[model samples]
Target: MSNTNSLTEHDHPSVLLPLLYESAGHLLSSAGALTGEQLRAASLLPGWTRAHVLVHLARGADSRVRLLTAARGGADLPQYPDESTREEEIRQGALRDADALRMDLETSLSGLLQAIGSHPDEAWDVPVRWLGGGRRPVRGVLWSLLRELEVHHVDLAASYTPADWPAAFTDRELRATVARLREDPAMPPVRISADGGTSDLSTSDRPGPLVRGAAAAILAWLTGRSDGAALTVDPPGALLPRVPAWRR
Candidate 1:
């Protein structure tokens, strides 16, 4: 999750590109279990249908491809024209038939894979701007794709759940989310503990409220994907700070 290692083997295009591919495969498999009619039903994300989630996932891959392609060829590009345009694109695309939606997803994933595969090693270090105006090496886009695929796969409201996430992904995301909280002055300084484990996400030396749960459960709470009602908060019944929405 510490994607700042632009020139390191960890964030290398060769490494992240394949991870994104496997994640895409997992997302596509979850999608495969849905019927065309089911696509019209509501997803875990409020006001979003299963089709909406699928559309966004497909377009997201294309967006990453644009960023990586520009990095490889040394051309200037933006992931989307603007937020409204991106939403509108997803809005229109969501109305497509299930077959067409799946096809578009596969097509977009292929395009991104090809873009990553064709890149030279040196090109991976070229700086690219993300939609939020933050910039990182081209390989950062691959890490972005990982969160998208994994999180949205669960948001599809199908078979995948937070518990379904691989232990490595869960552990990494937990650390990253904790780091994000630590940097935010407005975020409460709470202590997060893995049940029976030593890992703690605390900002200050003086520990605050203790939120105890498994790694995946704790992550879900931190990411705003879960309310953490199931987790045990120390002080016997104290309320945890309302976590701000997860950064996109």
Candidate 2:
């Protein structure tokens, strides 16, 4: 879905918050169902295991809480700790038995939901700096957070596939990812196909390439999980390299 399809200001805070909460809850439940060995299984992310992904999820929730706190006029939130530090924290915290991990995830998720639920509707208008440049309304930021959880939940590749992704999730996330890639100079021009239609995207400010496939497939390929092999590309050589990292 493109920005045009994004939730309007009036619908953002009220509608998106519960969606994000539910998505997070689903992810935690899925992670909790994994056995210790399963949790340790390798994921698509280079060397990270399922445990590492879960750790990132937990930390990410904490970070969102901090961001929301800052937007509410609390003191400056601390910068995210370095990757190695975070990885180690996840290694220690998420290596517990399945039940323990579930408990921990539930606790963290509860805190996040409570933080969001406590805010007055007016708080949605406050500006918050997103991970990317520029500030967006708190509602937009919250929606972005929901997008993060849904996208990464699939990245875990344990229970869901790109095709299985929620329609609302796919629409919002694909549009954001494509728009961001189109803006970055480091990436190349590429055509994205979704829902049997094609969207040509270019690195330049002008129009993008036109390619044809499912929207979820385009999202998967762009994120480095699926190669463009599944879609048709004109001048086949024009496709760009996959993104080096998924958005944090």
Candidate 3:
């Protein structure tokens, strides 16, 4: 499991690198036995096949490598020319046979791991432009890749589920997600309680109904990976408030 202990305002690449490797290893190992038919099956994400998910994962790794390279004083490279190009790449790559897709993913993962591991200590603080035109430190890029691997591993919907997520990841992600939602102007006013109120947080300043559930379940719901059926709202079965769409 990845050590999410270092996931702070300013992350540490040394700490995050090991976790990234672990996450990638788990994802690759879990999907190792997928057949062509299985790869063609729809993933948890709407309209996305397992092959599409795998291709997207691989492409994301390559993009991170480009960012890391630029952070190391190399020529700046665009993660992609544009959003259409990215979607087209995923669409085209998903048409490959199972072995081809697996090999592409493995290669991309190895390349990214090498880039991160061999990065200079001083360069971690260097900022690089992300696909969305926002700048983040090399360390942030590492953390983003880690998140991608762990979350999309469950998205594959083969054997992994939210229940299999590491406790460190679940707790950290839930808190981080709540914190983000708190700042969303469009977010509904609601109090979120996890683990039967052991952990409670309000989404906005204004008070509203309380939605409570297990930590993993709450994280899954907040991330749009699952419906909130496992969660219960206060006011004696009042409908759960519609939360703003989660940002990936």
Candidate 4:
């Protein structure tokens, strides 16, 4: 479950980290409720089991640790040797025993947190570049990690859903997504609004699709959490326009 915090324009990651830990703790407890068979059951991610989801979550932390460390020490290191190797590692870890999986997840999370804590206050704002190539402040890694945990927690398909998302996170993520969509060459020019005319999510001048809904519903649809089932689209129940994989 997510915290009930709201986002402010000046919110800081330092203040958000503990609440993210609480959210992760909640995710772990939910995972704990599953039996071994359930752990191996297929998740909402096509071809991935719940075990795969858990292991991916764990591996994500490890990858982040590598990035955080490089940011702190100003060293050059790859987040993973390669994407193929990363996938293989997840596959191998997913086959672990339930207890081993849990232990691995715990270990990964703690290790990354320690890495984050190792940074000097000034180091946190230093730019870190991913092996695949994009740079952002070290503190940005924390937000990405939190997004990974919270989003994949839903992907496990055990009991969580978008409704469990924190409003602040949803709002922030949704705004960021809209910014991306505006620049996306593939995304059709359209107008998007939520909450009865209070929100404008699109910057396009072209008159195309008009998607209107509650904030969470629009976020869920944009992020591939749903198929736009409950949203009101122009042309009436129109299918959601295709978009690239989310940039999370």
Measured over all alpha carbons after superposition, the RMSD of each candidate to the real structure, in angstroms, is 2.1, 3.8, 3.3, 4.2
- What does candidate 3 score on TM? 0.91
- Relative to the true structure, candidate 1 reaches a TM of 0.91
Worst 10-residue lDDT window for candidate 4 reads 1-10
Indicate which candidate wins on lDDT. 3
Worst 10 residues of 2 by lDDT: 1-10
Considering TM-score, which of the candidate structures 3 and 4 is the better prediction for this target?
A: 3
Q: Best TM-score goes to which candidate?
A: 1
Q: Identify the superior model by TM-score, candidate 2 or candidate 4.
A: 4
Quick one: how many clashes does candidate 1 have? Answer: 0
Clashes of each: 0, 10, 0, 0
CA lDDT of each candidate? 0.80, 0.67, 0.81, 0.76
Superior candidate under lDDT, 2 versus 3: 3
**lDDT order of candidates, top first:** 3, 1, 4, 2
Over 1-248, each residue of candidate 2 has an lDDT whose tens digit, in order, gives: 11233347535667777787788878887886788888778876777777777777777677667767877885455324455665677778766776776667777777877888887666766665544434555555466567667777776778777777777777656776878776676666665556643344444455556555677877787777677577766655666455645554
Clashing pairs in 4: none
- lDDT for each residue of candidate 4 in 182-222, tens digit (9 for 90 to 100): 77787777677877434686746677778888777888887
Every model's TM-score: 0.91, 0.81, 0.91, 0.88
Q: What would the per-residue lDDT of candidate 3 be over residues 1-248, giving only the tens digit for each residue? A: 12233346446666667777888889998778788899999999888999999999999999889988898875677677678898999999999999999999999999999998888887876777777776666676676787788889989998888888877667767777778888788778889888843478888889899888888888888888788899898987688777677543
